[model samples]
Target: MKVINLFALLFLLGCVVSCSQPESGITNESIAIIPLPDSYELKPGTFYITGQSSIGIDTSDAEMAALANYFNEKISDATGFSLPVGNSGTIVFQLGDYKELGEEGYRLSVLADKLVLNAYKHHGIFNGIQSVLQLLPAEIKSKEIQAHTTWSINCVEITDTPQFAWRGLMLDVSRHFFTKQEVKRFIDQMAEYKYNVFHWHLTDDQGWRLEVKSLPRLTSVGAWRAARVGNWWEREPQLPTDSLSYGGYYTAEDIREIVEYAQQRYVTIVPEIDIPGHSMAALSAYPEISCTGGPFQVNVGNTFYTKTENSLCAGNERTFEMLDSVFTEVTRLFPSPYIHIGGDECYKGFWEKCPKCKMRMQKEHLKNTEELQSYFVKRVADMIRKKGKQVIGWDEILEGGLAPEAIVMSWRGVKGGIEAAKQGHSVIMTPTDHCYLDFYQGDPIVEPNTYSMLRLQGCYKYQLVPDSVDASLIMGGQGNLWTESVPHYRQVEYMVWPRALAISETLWSDAQSRNWKFFVHRVEQQFRRFDLSGVNYARSIYDPIILPHLDKENRLKIELQTEVEGLNLFYTFDNTIPDVYSNTYTDTLTVPKNASMLRVAAYKGQKQAGRLIDITIEDLKKRAMEPKK
Candidate 1:
């Protein structure tokens, strides 16, 4: 045993205080794996993980070796031992021919004496180990060694094969740049959920996050902007005298390191150098590429619509020259099969007005600005394909015509994806209503302010493949965390989790086996793991959904419902805060005759489980005027 220092002692005390409180009342008898396995069977016994246990694997395989080491590192906090690999061990990992199970599929059997894991590829091993981690007690994720505790998993046989190939999460680093370490932490959590892709939105109107070594200004100028913390599009514009110290960019070495880090977890980092539209950062760096050249600053959240500098000058030869340089450098850094060229929201009015654009359109025999955009997209696609890569764009890429061999990321809605699939183009569906994580997942009054609401149920309930489209053309969907309002990493975690878990299951687990009630139970299990892991997660599901409405007499009436079953909603109309002792909501009720306000809260048993919603009677009337479904 090692001597415990003061710092370690305090940390253990903190973890102990938290670990004492388990997250849910759900029974441990069931195996609760998120993005639930394709099939599993509960057996009669349990496999206990003790100090004597060792992790077995073929160390000769570098991937397995790293995975084994990672697994050991993670569990070491609780077990207090480095389990040797490829030796006598209770846990064993083996890779063999499992074509039926697919590349990321695995088979695991945990018995009394020993546990065996079999997978065809390293990615399968990576995913299999995550399930193993979940099997252990939540305390196993603690930062300190757990003494007098049994780190055991139930005896079971699990066969998991993802139904979708592109299980992914897109982190928009452009709106708010997360540090390289933070990005790694995000990927680590995504990998644990069996997500195979990390779509990195590297550049947008707000900032450029990746360095193009040849085009130094892309970082020196484009990657920075004046700080503004109010509403995203309502912030005051950046002034010339303001200090541009709010942003940062990833260097070439940093990009390489992050990419390799993701690769180790079997995650492909798809870089999105968003262009044509959302190109204000690039335009700010090199104003020569815009229709109205010179004097363009990196956007400061305020809408710069019709300014015409937000989009790249599609007709300029210099724009292609700049893009070629950036694309060449991008291809050099990332080895992903596809690169995202943002062709969404490009204001064509500027293209229609520019002399260079008119000349190019005439030369190319194009009719409208949409065809001009198509020409630019086709050209950009050709440039990328020449570098041995495919192009991916927002649904707007379908605007004149989608480039040949291009992948469409349908952000507007499924309509675009369906159209793309019908046109024989691959589509990654990230429709804003369901897949946009940046939207408020809970009641916006208490949740972070955002444009829309995408509740966990809404995301989980969505059918990924629209029956109208050819299923083969639909790759998968991702939860896009566009961070205009998420200013830090913890907020990022809070926004992503629980909801992102819903996305993972929708994309990986077989649709037939997906159960909403059971999935909520699994989410509760994950909450405990996150608690022990020091990861931030939202408790919004426990919050009551408050809906204001007009009575037959046009009186103020409100309805409150909890998403998680059994969470009691308490309300008070007398201007006092509500607790567990307050009046419970059983049915619809109108505001009191002279009550000035209504305060509602949610509680699990005697403990507060959600944010308190306070609404003035006047505000309730306003909400009732525009009732939400």
Candidate 2:
């Protein structure tokens, strides 16, 4: 070892003191906290929650007192122990002048006898309380009181802060309506991970999920679609005997309840009202506003018809009138400073052919249909700004030219986000490859059929902020769970978790501090918590991704690798199920002659760890030849 100078030794000792490893009992391997805190030091001992303990808050501050009461209620519901509100107690929350803590950052200290939380804002205090809950037994998340459960927390000091201001999860409810209670539960889970934004995709081609009082037909006609089962993209058209009602929308009162619930958890709901394109539901309610003036019905299927006319009539003044009426009610219901006017996938072919559209193009001296979309987006942005709110749109809003005051939600890819940042507009990075939870996360044979592949590690490994873009303009990132294939809340939970947990840490924790192995360990901890809370989560991380390549002799060879280590992979060239006794995967194996299919599975010791993956030999060869995305 090299000798160190006295000053160097002192600096090293200081680092060791400030950044010590977590104590054994505090950072339990069985229950790791998601979105790991900025700085934490676990001390010996624990803070036991007894019947005598009470929650303390400043009664003068109504907001703080309410938050404290909320925590008390949750604890009481969980552990069968009621914590009364008092001026002094073992668990204390206080607002202090900690300017450095920021709005959503807090300092939490747990001593042997007392647990103290200090923050400058109520949002920070709420977040600190979430951390306290996580520190307790996983049973604390149970709705019913648990018998013989120890309500205690490890003694630790945590000064936690988020890396980004905006950490979000978008739930697309238009395709399949989720109940108000489900939405609240979603928000509650998101809050535990420090996600502050809930991007509600309330409108889409299939259905409209938000009610506009002025536009009665929106809910009356657009909210109900023909019931379709099986694959969403391959569903058959509705017959006369089929049920024409299979959807629901949130009433004004329902919106208020959900919004207030989110506010208490410090989650801002950004409601998305897709326009121009994906307007089939809207046009079904008011067909005169479309380029093709005829009757239309809410779409029950997921196929995007290229020849069909679904976009709004860009040239019609009636289109703007209808939009203004709808938006007027939307702005009143949602208090978010930024309103998402979906500017994505608007097929402009109808506008290119319509007489009114051509006339408007001539009047405005617009070159192409792309410019018409830009015009529509800019007009909507202006209207929304006039209502004291800014506009956020899909990356396509930059097709012809971006509005001067528009924010971009880059979903197609990071390129749009980069361009938006370059153009001096803020961007939220939600590229599909990393953030789209609807994509198939495991072996296509094992998981439900969806679009593309996005492994859990792929999400954890994403670099949200591109180096070329202005980092300041990069607001944050979000994961979107489109529900075309997910008809139930259980499937939604299955697709979002683990992956959402990865995205949460990506947005909240420092990028340099990320370690795949460490994160997976934490994920396993969350799995146990999810089990206790009756939440579904995917465990596809244990599955191995098969990669095929041709050897020097032109013989096809297959390679397999797991995301994490220690899992043994087994394979069979025949159409037989793989077991512990099957051929162990080590080096690349030659494609056996006369073998039509290959099956593979992973095992931890003697138990099967992941779903069995089966692939046809022809498909394997094609995959080998295709370039990786």
Candidate 3:
């Protein structure tokens, strides 16, 4: 038997192979990614193997270079391979478009002499990498390496692409500014999960995070705020020492770079500029645009549900002109097909009382405040379409009248998406119940802070398409991370991973071909990916937190929350064989994970679920270690 030197090899390849479906459910064989034209071919090799990238070396950005090198080293270390000297003898894996099937199609084909890695774009490359990680042996997957060989696979054909045209992740940067590098790091993580869209919440009541050439103060004044004394969630008294300088916006060049990087990965960045509502950030810098024309600070409180005075007046031509200029600059910066106009939770109390708003509503003959919001959305949608772009907004966009070209994102639930699709408009699913990552995965009593209801398995088992809806109007789905509470990068990583892996499988895998047992095994393999990569993940406490509620049928039901690709769920009364049809959950599941015969399920999408977890009472006792006081 050959001894596996995983440490050295894994460190070289920069990834650790964890688990694989062995013939008898246990074996130690090193699985190496053999580059094929359309897919990866598994080879049982004894020598050390390393994955090399064409990305040139840079010294100035040592952290970036180190990250790349670390990946290379880990893969090699796990496989017991030595780094090639002077780039000679390194397997030259050529990256190209492997569109043998269609968009998002990929394949690893092995011809006579070398390996070829091909995909539609960078995101495909990311997916291919995850797939390669799956083929590795289990010991390598679970933070250990094993030795065995005789890897083989029947030549198979795969026609794969994202389930939803828009698989996205939203990040709210207005509340807290993350460096450009931090943003890029987040993008890297998103790509790893095969999420193809990045919804950037760039502006909010806390601060403005984009620079408009015409609106100088937007960055100069609006972006900078007096030092925030306390957490927005906590009602601590403002400290006198609270100073007036606490933020920065992205420069056009910065955005251009970010856009290019995302483009390389086939990820579109949808930037949101709140209109009519969430305008405090803008009004803070340009007081002239406000009907009151008084100095305003970045709204520190949750005034959205309570106040009505901040609404942009439709009667004011300057309001339209300002929006025109902002949209013009925004359109020029982001070439995405759909621009997001936040239309959720706008308090109409201000519009009802404002002279400019009342007069304008009368002039336009709008029936009510809802119609006015619809009008505002349509006006922006019109401007966006004039520049040749579509528009997407929250469920609130459906309130007044959805523009023909506007796509509705059903964050509230499938009702909006179903309604919008029935109306012939495309819809992206982002129902907060399943896709909000900011929620606590474990019991709130155990791990307090997050407001979302998401857990690892919940993220894994999620289906972007509701069962009753027609498939034609479904554009795709996305996960949102509204960082009212997440203040650091590590927190972001903790909430996203494993779950994002589930999402990847969900988005990429075919709906009909899922097996829960296989998915659990796959996630088991991915644990090595997270452990070696230093990604801190939420624990299994989440299972009991959502399971008790899911086990019963109620008006409010539970849905499998996952974004992993290629997952399947299995359940059994006897626990012998999994019934895919009867066990599937469309709403809140009332079933228990530890029931007489609860079994693992498969997720068939680009999203991935975490491990096969059995929740114990002890699970509820665990808490996320808080930062030092």
Q: Candidate 3: list runs displaced more than 4 Å.
A: 1-100, 110-114, 118-126, 133-159, 226-231, 236-241, 301-304, 541-629
Question: Order the candidates by TM-score, highest first — what do you get?
Answer: 1, 2, 3
Quick one: best TM-score, which candidate? 1
- TM values, all candidates: 0.94, 0.92, 0.72
lDDT of 3 by residue, 1-629 (tens): 11112222222222222234233242312332211112122343222233332333233544334333433443454553433322223222223545544555555432223323345544454455444434333334432333442122222222235555678888988877777877877776676556778999998777889899998888887786655434454544234465657777899999999998777556789999877777777887887777677567775544344443555665577888988888888899998977888887776776776688788899999888889888888888898889877788888889988887788889886889988988888888888777888787764544537544676666666787777778877877888887777667777777776566666666665545344444555555455556665667664422322343311333222335433334454443344544345455445544344444334344343322334333332332222122221
User: Which structure is stronger by lDDT: 1 or 3?
Assistant: 1
What is the C-alpha lDDT profile of model 1 across 1-629, one tens digit per residue? 22111111111111100111112332332556777787776676778777788888777777788888877766665566667787447899889999898899999988878889899988898898878877765343343535666666767888999988998999999999899888988887898788999999999989998888889999999999999998888999998799999999999999999999889889999999887888889988898998988678888899888764688887789999999999999999999998988888888778877999999999999999999999999999999999999999999999998899899998887999999999999999989888999989888788888978889998898788998889999899899998999999999999998899999999998887767776787787777666655678998998888888887888777898988787899999999999988899999977888998888899988999889988788987887897474
lDDT winner, 2 or 3? 2
- Backbone clashes in model 2, listed as residue pairs: none
Ranking by lDDT: 1, 2, 3
Off by over 4 Å in 2: 1-31, 138-148, 302-304, 574-576
Output the worst ten-in-a-row residue range by lDDT, candidate 3: 1-10
- In order, the Cα lDDT scores of the candidates are 0.83, 0.83, 0.60
User: Candidate 1: TM-score?
Assistant: 0.94
